[model samples]
Target chain A: MRLSVFHPVSSLIYFAAVLIATMFCFSPAIQICSVVGALLELFMLESKREFFRNLRFTVVVWLAVAVTNPLFSHKGVTPLFFINGRAFTLEALLYGVMLGGSLSAVIMWFKVFSKVFDRERLLYIFGRKTPKLALIITMTRGFVPKLKAQYRRICDGRKCSGTYMSESRIERLKASCGIFTALCSSTLESAVQTGMSMKARGFGTGKRSFAHSFKFRFGDGVFLFVCILLFSAAMIYSGTGKLRADFYPRIAVSSEPLPMLCFAVLCAIPFILEVKESLKWKFCLAKI
Target chain B: MSKKTFSNLIFLLLIPLLCVAGLLFFRDKLYAWLSVGITVLCCAGYFLHFEGKEIKSAQLAIISAMTALSVFGRMCFAFLPGFKPCTALVIITGMYFGRESGFMTGAMTALISNFYFGQGAWTPFQMLVWGLTGYAAGMLAERLKKSRPTLLIFGAVSGPAFSLIMDLWSCIWADNGFVPPRCRKFFVRLYRNDAGILVSFKEFLCKITENWQVRRAQSR
Candidate 1:
């Protein structure tokens, strides 16, 4: 849904609120709303194939948790069935389903999180706060493709030397190990040099500054403020304990519809933003 | 161990104990939050540990290279169901460098590899286990370097140790408590998947560690 149109910080704050609420708020309605919102945003952002791929994994997780939890935790009343003389209670089953829903919702949000917060955005968001860690992560990202290339080169060299050839699986395995060892020593030596060279270049001395240079535009500020307002309203309402649902002994729902509506609106912010953006685009097209 | 690094290690150690205590106290409802808390704390702790230290760029580069190598090793072995050399390589890094470096290498390997493999709730648990493996190797570095057998034994022991922690995590995740039978089942399934690589894993790590040990001695 063009989440990247918002600033990284805005996106970060939005996801953080949703995640905290989903994990902490025990209301089934809130959790369901959060999952549906995340799924809707995911559908907008990803192709059908990719969306289904993610859905498949998350659904499996939900079903597995929902089905297995009741089997192990036999703590509720209203037994639905009995296995080996232990009553499989409805409360436990519902509780498990509730747990699964929240857990999967969290996962879905993170999936959306990963997709939206690509490398540059992450670097922009976290780079300044922890420069050394950011630098390491950046360097590692830069190094993987290079290292993979080097590994391929090494394998090719072995193949050319006739050392890599073998129908015998053990022989190829041994050659691969040799190749790995060779790559290790070379990389380690170069890395030591890289470290020493960095020492000469005056790194990690003090005030290591970084940012991908993201502009906090007027639109970003508006988005962020809206997120905070909605988040606080949802949280304060949920915090009053009116939005909590208790499943032990029997399912007793204690929630105000207004708080759930607050949460649902907060969750749907992405969709609203996308619709607004699309409408603007269509307006501009008509003008053209 | 400098005070900062030592304190950092203590923090790392305290988190899991606190997690267990939390699970016991809360008793079944807060596990998803608990996992989220763990993931955040581990990343924050790792960041704070390295943020302002007099760590050289070379040291940073070295850690990046080690992490890249470990991740590359993992990707290379992806075809084989469970024969991952990532743990053994991480242990080697720990044995060669200090503990913090080891922990960084191990943790970063999990984080970066998951970019390709797809991250989820399990990422933090994997990072914790692998990082601890490296940290333990660093702590026992003297013994690990002194003899071939000890190095081999540590390598041999680390696979099961990694699986043990992950299996424990799954038990907590699914059943919401320590269901022993479920844990045992996970352990066996994991151990069986891992059995094929243990011999070569240990042997390869011992050889690499021996090479570095000699070089380190010569340099000193």
Candidate 2:
């Protein structure tokens, strides 16, 4: 199994830490590291085609933002050139590039998030906090397809009666609306029965219990601990003014290796895990 | 002078004031963070508010059903891009059930339909805007029900409201044109007004639950 199987909250915490660090910190070093980390991680989890597709998009957005930043912003002292007597500054270009980098980082992270985080994981997270809301959401999600099926049935019946043979587009919309109305009423009617059934079964009477599917193993705990430590260290290290994320008046920064190393390790944690897991699998296959 | 006055001033005046100050200090650098924070907080607050309610199983089922209906409407009308009955259904749910329920239906409709469409950075914003529209419809339910013109006007206006919120977001992120006056006024007023709207939100919830408890007591 991939690192995604390592307790849902562990992955969630790791993702949250990365997001917070990337989001709040505007340093080029971290942003570049993030871009590399994201791309490599995407390559590890997803196919080569998926990796290239994301890379192509990220590069385009990064360049476009970088190029456009100089046009819109005339801040900073160093001007590469002038357009309409407005100074096109190097600092703005760098700032724009970083901005684009961070934006692309966000998109890539979310892409990775979508891959790791499926609907079940989403439900799991919400389910812990607000079971009722999660239940409602689940019911609603399940209900839509059922409603659609009913809508199809209604349309089929309508079609048989020559209702859809309307000569005009407007009439077709009208026919669809009529079907929708029928669907709505029928669903609402069934909703009452569903409610009655739920009432009889005694939902929301007291505290609810669940059969545990996800066990927090020792590895998960260690993973969580390492993530929090690195996140806080990076945050505090940056807070102490050892490293800065400043751009556009001047690209002000100081390179401190420790925090940067911390971030790299944090980002590489999953890549490391995936590699280890794959190697173990290969060894087992060789033995067989 | 009064306690309520001070509270209103804090929420209505001070929060927006602090937001502007933060905007000035950070400049455009933190727009991404700001948007993320806003989206997460708004959705979290909505869900938390939902959890703190006393809802019956029957009510929950109806809410799910209504939410399903709106999403289904959106899917059915996918052939015609601009002509989804999702908004209409949301408004109707709000008008009939109440604002919070309307908000739930609207928010969930956006949330669920996007699963079929595609989830993006814009999903939370869409949820917020649609939910707010349903909420406004709920708040103005009686007036809307009585007056056909008012309902029509609301239908007319809500389309722009969604677009406006989205435009403000895009303008902040993508538009390299640094700082228009209109944008400034809008940003300030929007923060101020939305914060201000929270007071009315509190009042509306109180009115709803108070009536609910009283009606329950009467029946008992």
User: Per-residue lDDT tens digits of candidate 2, residues A1-288?
Assistant: 466887889999999888766655757777877878888789898888878887898899889888977776678989999999989899988888887887788778877887897767777887977887788788998898898789889989988987664767767766776676677668877998999999899887867876548888998898889899988887677666655666658878775999888888887777887888889999999999
Compose the digit string of candidate 1's lDDT tens values, residues A1-288: 356767888889989888877766668888899999999888877899999998998899899878877776777879889999988899888887987898889888887888888889878866866777777788888888987899889889877877755867667667777777778888888788888888888765656665456788888888788778877877676556677677777788877788788889989988777778889999999999
TM-score of each: 0.83, 0.75
Worst 10 residues of 1 chain A by lDDT: A204-213
In model 2, the clashing pairs are none
Q: Point out where model 2 deviates above 4 Å.
A: A47-71, A76-91, A147-189, A252-255, B1-39, B69-86, B110-126, B170-178, B181-220
- Best-fitting candidate, scored by lDDT: 1
Judged by DockQ cut-offs, the docking class of candidate 1 is acceptable
Question: Where in model 1 is the C-alpha error above 4 Å?
Answer: A75-92, A158-179, A196-211, B1-28, B31-39, B173-181, B190-197, B210-220
**Interface RMSD after interface superposition, each candidate:** 3.8, 6.7
Report, in order, each candidate's fnat. Answer: 0.61, 0.57
DockQ of each: 0.44, 0.32
